[model samples]
Target chain A: MSVTLDQARKIIRQTMAKGEDMKLKPLSVVVLDAGGHVVAFERSDDASPGRFGIAHGKAYGAVMLGMAGTAQMKRAEDQAYFMAAVNGVFGGHVVPVPGGVLLRNAAGKVVGAVGVTGDSSDNDATAAMAGIEAAALVGEI
Target chain B: MSVTLDQARKIIRQTMAKGEDMKLKPLSVVVLDAGGHVVAFERSDDASPGRFGIAHGKAYGAVMLGMAGTAQMKRAEDQAYFMAAVNGVFGGHVVPVPGGVLLRNAAGKVVGAVGVTGDSSDNDATAAMAGIEAAALVGEI
Candidate 1:
Protein backbone atom coordinates (compact mmCIF):
# COMPACT_ATOMS: atom_id res chain seq x y z
CA MET A 1 0.00 0.00 0.00
CA SER A 2 1.11 3.57 -0.62
CA VAL A 3 0.79 6.58 1.62
CA THR A 4 -0.97 9.59 0.18
CA LEU A 5 0.09 13.14 0.88
CA ASP A 6 -3.05 13.66 2.95
CA GLN A 7 -2.23 10.64 5.08
CA ALA A 8 1.30 11.87 5.57
CA ARG A 9 0.02 15.25 6.70
CA LYS A 10 -2.38 13.61 9.06
CA ILE A 11 0.49 11.67 10.60
CA ILE A 12 2.44 14.84 11.16
CA ARG A 13 -0.47 16.67 12.71
CA GLN A 14 -1.36 13.83 15.02
CA THR A 15 2.28 13.38 16.00
CA MET A 16 2.55 17.00 16.97
CA ALA A 17 -0.64 16.78 18.98
CA LYS A 18 0.69 13.82 20.91
CA GLY A 19 3.88 15.70 21.62
CA GLU A 20 1.88 18.66 22.90
CA ASP A 21 -0.36 16.50 25.07
CA MET A 22 2.66 14.99 26.73
CA LYS A 23 4.18 18.41 27.42
CA LEU A 24 7.28 17.41 25.51
CA LYS A 25 9.88 19.84 24.26
CA PRO A 26 9.62 21.47 20.85
CA LEU A 27 9.45 18.66 18.33
CA SER A 28 10.38 17.95 14.75
CA VAL A 29 8.56 15.36 12.72
CA VAL A 30 8.93 13.77 9.29
CA VAL A 31 6.79 11.30 7.42
CA LEU A 32 8.04 9.16 4.54
CA ASP A 33 6.39 6.90 2.01
CA ALA A 34 7.25 3.26 1.52
CA GLY A 35 10.02 4.29 -0.83
CA GLY A 36 11.61 6.45 1.83
CA HIS A 37 10.55 9.60 0.03
CA VAL A 38 9.47 12.53 2.12
CA VAL A 39 5.73 13.15 2.07
CA ALA A 40 5.60 15.89 4.71
CA PHE A 41 7.67 17.34 7.47
CA GLU A 42 7.39 20.05 10.11
CA ARG A 43 9.40 21.35 13.04
CA SER A 44 8.54 23.76 15.81
CA ASP A 45 10.09 27.20 15.63
CA ASP A 46 12.39 26.42 18.54
CA ALA A 47 13.78 23.29 16.90
CA SER A 48 17.38 23.46 15.77
CA PRO A 49 18.64 23.18 12.21
CA GLY A 50 19.74 19.59 12.74
CA ARG A 51 16.23 18.50 13.70
CA PHE A 52 15.05 18.13 10.14
CA GLY A 53 17.85 15.85 9.12
CA ILE A 54 17.55 13.82 12.28
CA ALA A 55 13.85 13.23 11.80
CA HIS A 56 14.14 12.59 8.06
CA GLY A 57 17.12 10.29 8.37
CA LYS A 58 15.49 8.33 11.11
CA ALA A 59 12.38 7.64 9.07
CA TYR A 60 14.40 7.00 5.93
CA GLY A 61 16.59 4.45 7.64
CA ALA A 62 13.60 2.69 9.13
CA VAL A 63 11.85 2.37 5.78
CA MET A 64 14.96 1.32 3.92
CA LEU A 65 16.00 -1.31 6.47
CA GLY A 66 12.49 -2.56 7.16
CA MET A 67 13.17 -2.13 10.84
CA ALA A 68 11.72 0.19 13.42
CA GLY A 69 13.91 2.74 15.20
CA THR A 70 13.69 0.82 18.43
CA ALA A 71 14.78 -2.35 16.66
CA GLN A 72 17.66 -0.54 15.06
CA MET A 73 18.76 0.86 18.37
CA LYS A 74 18.90 -2.64 19.79
CA ARG A 75 20.91 -3.82 16.81
CA ALA A 76 23.22 -0.84 16.96
CA GLU A 77 24.63 -1.93 20.29
CA ASP A 78 25.98 -5.31 19.15
CA GLN A 79 26.36 -4.75 15.43
CA ALA A 80 28.60 -1.73 15.26
CA TYR A 81 29.87 -2.41 11.77
CA PHE A 82 26.40 -3.07 10.47
CA MET A 83 25.09 0.25 11.64
CA ALA A 84 28.30 1.92 10.47
CA ALA A 85 27.89 0.52 6.99
CA VAL A 86 24.24 1.53 6.95
CA ASN A 87 25.00 5.16 7.84
CA GLY A 88 27.99 5.24 5.53
CA VAL A 89 26.07 4.02 2.51
CA PHE A 90 23.09 6.28 3.29
CA GLY A 91 25.09 9.53 3.47
CA GLY A 92 25.78 9.38 7.20
CA HIS A 93 22.48 10.89 8.23
CA VAL A 94 20.65 7.71 9.27
CA VAL A 95 19.61 8.09 12.86
CA PRO A 96 19.39 4.56 14.25
CA VAL A 97 17.96 5.66 17.55
CA PRO A 98 14.40 5.52 18.79
CA GLY A 99 11.60 7.93 17.81
CA GLY A 100 11.13 6.42 14.36
CA VAL A 101 8.14 4.09 13.98
CA LEU A 102 6.79 2.20 11.01
CA LEU A 103 3.14 2.38 9.93
CA ARG A 104 1.70 -0.95 8.99
CA ASN A 105 -1.50 -1.64 7.11
CA ALA A 106 -4.01 -4.27 8.13
CA ALA A 107 -2.12 -6.80 6.05
CA GLY A 108 0.94 -6.02 8.15
CA LYS A 109 2.70 -4.50 5.20
CA VAL A 110 4.78 -1.48 5.93
CA VAL A 111 3.13 1.54 4.34
CA GLY A 112 5.38 4.24 5.71
CA ALA A 113 7.23 5.54 8.75
CA VAL A 114 7.17 8.54 11.05
CA GLY A 115 10.08 10.11 12.92
CA VAL A 116 10.12 12.59 15.75
CA THR A 117 12.99 14.36 17.51
CA GLY A 118 13.77 17.20 19.97
CA ASP A 119 12.70 15.24 23.04
CA SER A 120 13.90 12.11 24.75
CA SER A 121 14.03 9.19 22.38
CA ASP A 122 11.52 7.22 24.43
CA ASN A 123 9.06 10.09 24.52
CA ASP A 124 9.58 10.79 20.88
CA ALA A 125 8.89 7.17 20.06
CA THR A 126 5.81 7.18 22.26
CA ALA A 127 4.47 10.20 20.42
CA ALA A 128 5.17 8.65 17.01
CA MET A 129 3.40 5.41 18.01
CA ALA A 130 0.41 7.31 19.29
CA GLY A 131 0.12 9.26 16.09
CA ILE A 132 0.22 6.14 13.96
CA GLU A 133 -2.46 4.50 16.14
CA ALA A 134 -4.61 7.60 16.03
CA ALA A 135 -4.54 7.64 12.25
CA ALA A 136 -6.42 4.31 12.21
CA LEU A 137 -3.24 2.43 11.32
CA VAL A 138 -1.07 -0.07 13.15
CA GLY A 139 2.36 0.67 14.53
CA GLU A 140 5.37 -1.63 14.23
CA ILE A 141 7.66 0.18 16.56
CA MET B 1 19.37 -12.22 -17.13
CA SER B 2 19.16 -10.30 -13.86
CA VAL B 3 21.91 -8.07 -12.55
CA THR B 4 23.94 -10.05 -10.03
CA LEU B 5 27.15 -9.44 -8.14
CA ASP B 6 28.98 -10.89 -11.10
CA GLN B 7 27.25 -8.45 -13.41
CA ALA B 8 27.98 -5.50 -11.17
CA ARG B 9 31.68 -6.36 -10.94
CA LYS B 10 31.88 -6.83 -14.68
CA ILE B 11 30.43 -3.38 -15.22
CA ILE B 12 32.90 -1.83 -12.84
CA ARG B 13 35.85 -3.64 -14.39
CA GLN B 14 34.89 -2.73 -17.92
CA THR B 15 34.19 0.88 -16.99
CA MET B 16 37.62 1.26 -15.40
CA ALA B 17 39.35 -0.45 -18.32
CA LYS B 18 37.60 1.82 -20.78
CA GLY B 19 38.78 4.85 -18.83
CA GLU B 20 42.31 3.52 -18.84
CA ASP B 21 42.34 2.80 -22.60
CA MET B 22 41.05 6.28 -23.30
CA LYS B 23 43.82 7.78 -21.10
CA LEU B 24 41.23 9.57 -19.02
CA LYS B 25 41.99 10.91 -15.59
CA PRO B 26 41.97 8.60 -12.63
CA LEU B 27 38.41 7.34 -12.67
CA SER B 28 36.00 6.16 -10.05
CA VAL B 29 32.99 4.03 -10.84
CA VAL B 30 29.85 2.82 -9.10
CA VAL B 31 27.28 0.23 -10.13
CA LEU B 32 23.79 0.48 -8.74
CA ASP B 33 20.93 -1.91 -9.20
CA ALA B 34 17.51 -0.61 -10.28
CA GLY B 35 16.65 -0.20 -6.63
CA GLY B 36 19.33 2.49 -6.44
CA HIS B 37 21.36 0.39 -4.07
CA VAL B 38 25.11 0.19 -4.56
CA VAL B 39 26.24 -3.18 -5.76
CA ALA B 40 29.89 -2.43 -6.35
CA PHE B 41 32.25 0.55 -6.43
CA GLU B 42 35.90 1.10 -7.22
CA ARG B 43 38.21 4.06 -7.62
CA SER B 44 41.69 4.46 -9.02
CA ASP B 45 44.43 5.20 -6.54
CA ASP B 46 44.77 8.77 -7.73
CA ALA B 47 41.05 9.48 -7.73
CA SER B 48 39.82 11.77 -5.00
CA PRO B 49 37.45 10.60 -2.29
CA GLY B 50 34.67 12.78 -3.66
CA ARG B 51 34.83 10.91 -6.95
CA PHE B 52 33.05 7.92 -5.43
CA GLY B 53 30.27 10.09 -4.03
CA ILE B 54 29.92 11.99 -7.32
CA ALA B 55 29.58 8.83 -9.35
CA HIS B 56 27.24 7.27 -6.81
CA GLY B 57 25.04 10.34 -6.60
CA LYS B 58 24.90 10.74 -10.34
CA ALA B 59 23.83 7.15 -10.82
CA TYR B 60 21.39 7.36 -7.90
CA GLY B 61 19.80 10.50 -9.32
CA ALA B 62 19.43 8.92 -12.73
CA VAL B 63 17.80 5.82 -11.29
CA MET B 64 15.43 7.82 -9.10
CA LEU B 65 14.51 10.21 -11.94
CA GLY B 66 14.20 7.29 -14.39
CA MET B 67 16.43 9.27 -16.73
CA ALA B 68 19.82 8.60 -18.19
CA GLY B 69 22.62 10.96 -17.26
CA THR B 70 22.40 12.90 -20.52
CA ALA B 71 18.65 13.00 -20.22
CA GLN B 72 18.97 14.49 -16.76
CA MET B 73 21.54 16.99 -17.99
CA LYS B 74 19.19 18.19 -20.69
CA ARG B 75 16.36 18.44 -18.22
CA ALA B 76 18.55 20.27 -15.74
CA GLU B 77 19.25 23.02 -18.25
CA ASP B 78 15.55 23.62 -18.78
CA GLN B 79 14.53 22.99 -15.17
CA ALA B 80 17.27 24.68 -13.26
CA TYR B 81 15.07 25.57 -10.34
CA PHE B 82 13.51 22.15 -10.33
CA MET B 83 16.89 20.44 -10.19
CA ALA B 84 17.94 22.98 -7.61
CA ALA B 85 15.11 21.79 -5.40
CA VAL B 86 15.93 18.15 -6.12
CA ASN B 87 19.54 18.49 -5.05
CA GLY B 88 18.62 20.65 -2.12
CA VAL B 89 16.09 18.17 -0.77
CA PHE B 90 18.31 15.21 -1.58
CA GLY B 91 21.11 16.22 0.77
CA GLY B 92 22.71 18.58 -1.75
CA HIS B 93 24.79 15.93 -3.56
CA VAL B 94 22.70 14.85 -6.55
CA VAL B 95 24.82 15.36 -9.65
CA PRO B 96 22.66 15.98 -12.71
CA VAL B 97 25.64 16.01 -15.08
CA PRO B 98 26.31 13.27 -17.61
CA GLY B 99 28.29 10.04 -16.98
CA GLY B 100 25.62 7.75 -15.56
CA VAL B 101 24.24 5.27 -18.09
CA LEU B 102 21.18 3.14 -17.46
CA LEU B 103 21.41 -0.49 -18.42
CA ARG B 104 18.45 -2.07 -20.14
CA ASN B 105 17.60 -5.71 -20.54
CA ALA B 106 16.57 -7.46 -23.77
CA ALA B 107 12.99 -6.72 -22.79
CA GLY B 108 13.78 -3.02 -22.40
CA LYS B 109 13.57 -3.14 -18.66
CA VAL B 110 15.98 -1.02 -16.66
CA VAL B 111 18.15 -3.42 -14.63
CA GLY B 112 20.78 -1.08 -13.32
CA ALA B 113 23.20 1.76 -14.09
CA VAL B 114 26.92 2.48 -14.08
CA GLY B 115 28.39 5.83 -13.08
CA VAL B 116 31.86 7.02 -14.09
CA THR B 117 33.81 10.11 -13.02
CA GLY B 118 37.26 11.78 -13.19
CA ASP B 119 37.03 12.97 -16.80
CA SER B 120 34.91 15.35 -18.77
CA SER B 121 31.22 14.63 -18.46
CA ASP B 122 30.98 13.59 -22.11
CA ASN B 123 34.01 11.33 -21.90
CA ASP B 124 32.74 9.85 -18.69
CA ALA B 125 29.47 9.11 -20.39
CA THR B 126 31.34 7.47 -23.23
CA ALA B 127 33.24 5.24 -20.85
CA ALA B 128 30.01 4.32 -19.10
CA MET B 129 28.48 3.38 -22.45
CA ALA B 130 31.49 1.30 -23.40
CA GLY B 131 31.32 -0.57 -20.14
CA ILE B 132 27.65 -1.35 -20.56
CA GLU B 133 28.22 -2.56 -24.09
CA ALA B 134 31.20 -4.70 -23.11
CA ALA B 135 29.03 -6.38 -20.52
CA ALA B 136 26.70 -7.49 -23.33
CA LEU B 137 24.07 -5.13 -21.99
CA VAL B 138 22.25 -2.34 -23.82
CA GLY B 139 22.46 1.13 -22.32
CA GLU B 140 20.18 4.14 -22.46
CA ILE B 141 23.04 6.59 -22.33
Candidate 2:
Protein backbone atom coordinates (compact mmCIF):
# COMPACT_ATOMS: atom_id res chain seq x y z
CA MET A 1 0.00 0.00 0.00
CA SER A 2 1.07 3.57 -0.54
CA VAL A 3 2.08 5.91 2.24
CA THR A 4 -0.90 7.69 3.76
CA LEU A 5 -1.03 11.41 4.49
CA ASP A 6 -0.83 10.93 8.25
CA GLN A 7 2.13 8.61 7.87
CA ALA A 8 3.89 11.08 5.62
CA ARG A 9 3.43 14.01 7.98
CA LYS A 10 4.40 11.86 10.94
CA ILE A 11 7.67 11.07 9.19
CA ILE A 12 8.40 14.72 8.70
CA ARG A 13 7.58 15.68 12.27
CA GLN A 14 9.52 12.80 13.75
CA THR A 15 12.56 13.64 11.66
CA MET A 16 12.53 17.23 12.80
CA ALA A 17 12.19 16.09 16.39
CA LYS A 18 15.19 13.84 15.95
CA GLY A 19 17.20 16.78 14.66
CA GLU A 20 16.17 18.76 17.70
CA ASP A 21 17.22 16.00 20.06
CA MET A 22 20.64 15.89 18.44
CA LYS A 23 20.98 19.63 18.97
CA LEU A 24 21.32 20.06 15.25
CA LYS A 25 20.20 23.12 13.38
CA PRO A 26 16.54 23.50 12.64
CA LEU A 27 15.44 21.36 9.72
CA SER A 28 12.96 21.16 6.91
CA VAL A 29 11.49 17.78 6.07
CA VAL A 30 9.43 16.49 3.17
CA VAL A 31 7.71 13.22 2.34
CA LEU A 32 6.71 12.19 -1.15
CA ASP A 33 4.53 9.36 -2.36
CA ALA A 34 5.81 6.75 -4.81
CA GLY A 35 4.23 8.67 -7.65
CA GLY A 36 6.54 11.65 -7.00
CA HIS A 37 3.77 13.72 -5.49
CA VAL A 38 4.30 15.55 -2.21
CA VAL A 39 2.31 14.00 0.61
CA ALA A 40 3.49 16.04 3.56
CA PHE A 41 6.10 18.69 4.37
CA GLU A 42 7.25 20.99 7.17
CA ARG A 43 9.95 23.50 7.97
CA SER A 44 11.18 24.04 11.50
CA ASP A 45 10.48 27.52 12.77
CA ASP A 46 14.11 28.51 12.57
CA ALA A 47 14.94 26.78 9.33
CA SER A 48 16.43 28.85 6.58
CA PRO A 49 14.18 30.40 3.97
CA GLY A 50 14.94 27.92 1.19
CA ARG A 51 15.09 24.73 3.21
CA PHE A 52 11.57 23.61 2.28
CA GLY A 53 12.25 23.55 -1.45
CA ILE A 54 15.61 21.85 -0.94
CA ALA A 55 14.13 19.16 1.26
CA HIS A 56 11.25 18.58 -1.16
CA GLY A 57 13.63 18.37 -4.09
CA LYS A 58 15.69 15.77 -2.30
CA ALA A 59 12.64 13.64 -1.55
CA TYR A 60 11.37 13.99 -5.09
CA GLY A 61 14.74 12.88 -6.41
CA ALA A 62 14.79 9.76 -4.24
CA VAL A 63 11.33 8.71 -5.42
CA MET A 64 12.08 9.57 -9.03
CA LEU A 65 15.32 7.56 -9.09
CA GLY A 66 14.08 4.72 -6.89
CA MET A 67 17.26 5.03 -4.83
CA ALA A 68 18.64 6.77 -1.78
CA GLY A 69 19.76 10.37 -2.17
CA THR A 70 23.35 9.45 -1.34
CA ALA A 71 23.33 6.89 -4.09
CA GLN A 72 22.08 9.47 -6.51
CA MET A 73 24.78 11.83 -5.34
CA LYS A 74 27.40 9.21 -6.11
CA ARG A 75 25.93 8.70 -9.55
CA ALA A 76 25.86 12.43 -10.18
CA GLU A 77 29.39 12.93 -8.96
CA ASP A 78 30.73 11.37 -12.11
CA GLN A 79 28.28 13.18 -14.39
CA ALA A 80 27.25 16.46 -12.89
CA TYR A 81 26.26 17.95 -16.22
CA PHE A 82 24.04 15.03 -17.09
CA MET A 83 22.43 15.13 -13.69
CA ALA A 84 21.80 18.85 -13.97
CA ALA A 85 20.16 18.33 -17.34
CA VAL A 86 18.00 15.64 -15.80
CA ASN A 87 16.94 18.00 -13.05
CA GLY A 88 16.10 20.63 -15.62
CA VAL A 89 13.82 18.16 -17.34
CA PHE A 90 11.92 17.67 -14.06
CA GLY A 91 11.74 21.37 -13.21
CA GLY A 92 14.56 21.08 -10.64
CA HIS A 93 12.85 18.49 -8.44
CA VAL A 94 15.90 16.25 -8.53
CA VAL A 95 18.51 16.93 -5.90
CA PRO A 96 21.81 15.10 -5.61
CA VAL A 97 22.15 15.17 -1.86
CA PRO A 98 22.57 12.89 1.15
CA GLY A 99 19.44 13.60 3.16
CA GLY A 100 16.90 11.73 1.08
CA VAL A 101 16.02 8.10 1.81
CA LEU A 102 13.76 5.55 0.19
CA LEU A 103 10.98 4.33 2.46
CA ARG A 104 9.31 0.93 2.43
CA ASN A 105 6.25 -0.50 4.06
CA ALA A 106 6.32 -3.45 6.50
CA ALA A 107 6.19 -5.81 3.56
CA GLY A 108 9.45 -4.32 2.25
CA LYS A 109 7.80 -2.73 -0.72
CA VAL A 110 8.99 0.74 -1.57
CA VAL A 111 6.29 3.24 -0.69
CA GLY A 112 7.79 6.70 -0.62
CA ALA A 113 10.68 8.82 0.67
CA VAL A 114 11.67 11.17 3.44
CA GLY A 115 14.01 14.12 2.94
CA VAL A 116 15.63 16.30 5.57
CA THR A 117 17.66 19.50 5.27
CA GLY A 118 19.48 22.14 7.38
CA ASP A 119 22.10 19.93 9.04
CA SER A 120 25.29 18.32 7.80
CA SER A 121 24.60 15.78 5.10
CA ASP A 122 25.51 12.90 7.40
CA ASN A 123 23.30 14.24 10.16
CA ASP A 124 20.49 14.87 7.76
CA ALA A 125 20.63 11.28 6.60
CA THR A 126 20.68 10.09 10.19
CA ALA A 127 17.59 12.09 11.03
CA ALA A 128 15.74 10.88 7.98
CA MET A 129 16.54 7.28 8.82
CA ALA A 130 15.41 7.84 12.38
CA GLY A 131 12.12 9.18 11.12
CA ILE A 132 11.59 6.09 9.00
CA GLU A 133 12.30 3.91 11.98
CA ALA A 134 9.90 5.88 14.09
CA ALA A 135 7.24 5.24 11.51
CA ALA A 136 8.18 1.55 11.47
CA LEU A 137 9.03 1.86 7.82
CA VAL A 138 12.14 0.40 6.23
CA GLY A 139 14.54 2.98 4.95
CA GLU A 140 17.58 3.05 2.71
CA ILE A 141 19.81 5.84 3.85
CA MET B 1 -0.37 31.01 15.75
CA SER B 2 1.16 29.42 12.70
CA VAL B 3 -0.41 26.54 10.88
CA THR B 4 1.07 23.33 12.18
CA LEU B 5 2.10 20.59 9.76
CA ASP B 6 -0.86 18.50 10.91
CA GLN B 7 -3.26 21.35 10.28
CA ALA B 8 -1.79 22.03 6.87
CA ARG B 9 -2.05 18.46 5.66
CA LYS B 10 -5.50 18.12 7.15
CA ILE B 11 -6.56 21.14 5.16
CA ILE B 12 -5.27 19.63 1.96
CA ARG B 13 -6.78 16.24 2.60
CA GLN B 14 -10.16 17.59 3.59
CA THR B 15 -10.29 19.83 0.56
CA MET B 16 -9.69 16.86 -1.69
CA ALA B 17 -12.39 14.96 0.16
CA LYS B 18 -14.77 17.83 -0.45
CA GLY B 19 -13.94 17.72 -4.15
CA GLU B 20 -14.75 14.04 -4.21
CA ASP B 21 -17.98 14.56 -2.33
CA MET B 22 -19.06 17.16 -4.86
CA LYS B 23 -18.28 14.82 -7.75
CA LEU B 24 -15.69 17.25 -9.02
CA LYS B 25 -12.48 16.35 -10.78
CA PRO B 26 -9.39 15.18 -8.98
CA LEU B 27 -7.69 18.03 -7.17
CA SER B 28 -4.37 19.39 -6.04
CA VAL B 29 -4.15 21.37 -2.83
CA VAL B 30 -1.46 23.45 -1.16
CA VAL B 31 -1.01 25.24 2.16
CA LEU B 32 1.46 28.03 2.86
CA ASP B 33 2.64 29.61 6.07
CA ALA B 34 2.15 33.26 6.84
CA GLY B 35 5.51 33.95 5.31
CA GLY B 36 4.39 32.32 2.07
CA HIS B 37 6.54 29.25 2.56
CA VAL B 38 4.87 25.99 1.63
CA VAL B 39 3.92 23.86 4.62
CA ALA B 40 2.07 21.03 2.90
CA PHE B 41 0.91 19.99 -0.56
CA GLU B 42 -0.98 17.10 -2.11
CA ARG B 43 -2.17 16.01 -5.52
CA SER B 44 -4.93 13.47 -6.03
CA ASP B 45 -3.85 10.43 -8.02
CA ASP B 46 -5.90 11.49 -11.02
CA ALA B 47 -5.35 15.23 -10.84
CA SER B 48 -4.14 17.05 -13.95
CA PRO B 49 -0.41 17.25 -14.52
CA GLY B 50 0.08 20.94 -13.81
CA ARG B 51 -2.43 21.26 -11.00
CA PHE B 52 0.22 21.21 -8.31
CA GLY B 53 1.99 24.33 -9.51
CA ILE B 54 -1.30 26.06 -10.18
CA ALA B 55 -2.58 25.24 -6.70
CA HIS B 56 0.63 26.44 -5.10
CA GLY B 57 0.57 29.63 -7.15
CA LYS B 58 -2.93 30.40 -6.02
CA ALA B 59 -2.03 29.98 -2.35
CA TYR B 60 1.12 32.05 -2.73
CA GLY B 61 -0.82 34.83 -4.42
CA ALA B 62 -3.39 34.91 -1.64
CA VAL B 63 -0.78 35.09 1.09
CA MET B 64 1.44 37.56 -0.70
CA LEU B 65 -1.37 39.92 -1.64
CA GLY B 66 -3.31 39.58 1.63
CA MET B 67 -6.51 38.96 -0.30
CA ALA B 68 -8.63 36.09 -1.53
CA GLY B 69 -7.70 34.66 -4.91
CA THR B 70 -10.88 36.07 -6.47
CA ALA B 71 -10.07 39.55 -5.24
CA GLN B 72 -6.58 39.30 -6.66
CA MET B 73 -8.07 38.22 -9.98
CA LYS B 74 -10.27 41.29 -10.01
CA ARG B 75 -7.33 43.55 -9.34
CA ALA B 76 -5.28 41.83 -11.99
CA GLU B 77 -8.05 41.98 -14.57
CA ASP B 78 -7.60 45.71 -15.11
CA GLN B 79 -3.79 45.53 -15.14
CA ALA B 80 -2.77 42.41 -16.96
CA TYR B 81 0.72 43.73 -17.60
CA PHE B 82 1.22 44.64 -13.97
CA MET B 83 -0.03 41.22 -12.84
CA ALA B 84 2.31 39.51 -15.27
CA ALA B 85 5.21 41.60 -14.00
CA VAL B 86 4.37 40.76 -10.42
CA ASN B 87 4.34 37.08 -11.20
CA GLY B 88 7.62 37.39 -13.15
CA VAL B 89 9.28 39.14 -10.23
CA PHE B 90 8.14 36.36 -7.89
CA GLY B 91 9.31 33.62 -10.24
CA GLY B 92 5.70 32.86 -11.21
CA HIS B 93 4.49 32.07 -7.70
CA VAL B 94 1.45 34.29 -8.05
CA VAL B 95 -1.81 33.09 -9.57
CA PRO B 96 -4.79 35.38 -9.86
CA VAL B 97 -7.45 32.72 -9.57
CA PRO B 98 -10.54 32.00 -7.53
CA GLY B 99 -9.34 28.95 -5.64
CA GLY B 100 -7.17 30.57 -3.00
CA VAL B 101 -8.33 31.86 0.36
CA LEU B 102 -6.73 33.55 3.34
CA LEU B 103 -6.75 31.67 6.65
CA ARG B 104 -7.10 33.39 9.97
CA ASN B 105 -6.41 31.98 13.38
CA ALA B 106 -8.51 32.23 16.55
CA ALA B 107 -7.38 35.78 17.07
CA GLY B 108 -8.58 36.66 13.61
CA LYS B 109 -5.06 37.22 12.41
CA VAL B 110 -4.10 36.00 8.98
CA VAL B 111 -1.97 32.93 9.48
CA GLY B 112 -1.68 31.35 6.03
CA ALA B 113 -3.61 30.30 2.95
CA VAL B 114 -5.06 27.26 1.22
CA GLY B 115 -5.42 26.77 -2.52
CA VAL B 116 -7.29 24.17 -4.53
CA THR B 117 -7.28 23.37 -8.23
CA GLY B 118 -9.06 20.91 -10.51
CA ASP B 119 -12.65 21.95 -11.21
CA SER B 120 -14.03 25.33 -12.25
CA SER B 121 -12.91 28.40 -10.33
CA ASP B 122 -16.05 28.63 -8.21
CA ASN B 123 -15.89 24.95 -7.36
CA ASP B 124 -12.25 25.27 -6.50
CA ALA B 125 -13.00 28.14 -4.14
CA THR B 126 -15.77 26.15 -2.54
CA ALA B 127 -13.45 23.25 -1.87
CA ALA B 128 -10.72 25.43 -0.45
CA MET B 129 -13.13 27.22 1.82
CA ALA B 130 -14.49 23.94 3.06
CA GLY B 131 -10.99 22.85 3.95
CA ILE B 132 -10.29 26.00 5.90
CA GLU B 133 -13.54 25.58 7.76
CA ALA B 134 -12.70 21.97 8.53
CA ALA B 135 -9.46 23.13 10.07
CA ALA B 136 -11.40 25.56 12.27
CA LEU B 137 -9.68 28.48 10.64
CA VAL B 138 -11.40 31.58 9.25
CA GLY B 139 -11.24 31.89 5.51
CA GLU B 140 -11.96 34.61 2.97
CA ILE B 141 -13.19 32.97 -0.17
Stretches of candidate 2 off by over 4 Å are A1-7, A20-24, A76-92, A104-111, A133-137, B1-10, B13-27, B45-49, B76-81, B105-109, B134-136
lDDT of 2 at B15: 92
Question: Which one is best on lDDT?
Answer: 2
Give the Å error, residue B119, model 1. Answer: 39
Best by DockQ: 2
Each prediction's whole-model lDDT (CA): 0.79, 0.83
Clashing residue pairs for model 1: none
Stretches of candidate 1 above 4 Å error? B1-141
What are the chain B TM-scores of all models?
A: 0.93, 0.94
Cα error, candidate 2, residue A51 (Å): 1.9
Error of 1 at B21 (Å): 45
**Each candidate's chain A: what TM-score?**
0.95, 0.94
In the range B14-79, model 2's lDDT, one tens digit per residue, is 898899999999888888889888877777766654666798888898888888888888889988
Model 1 lDDT tens row, B72-123: 7776667666765676566655677688888888888888878888787789
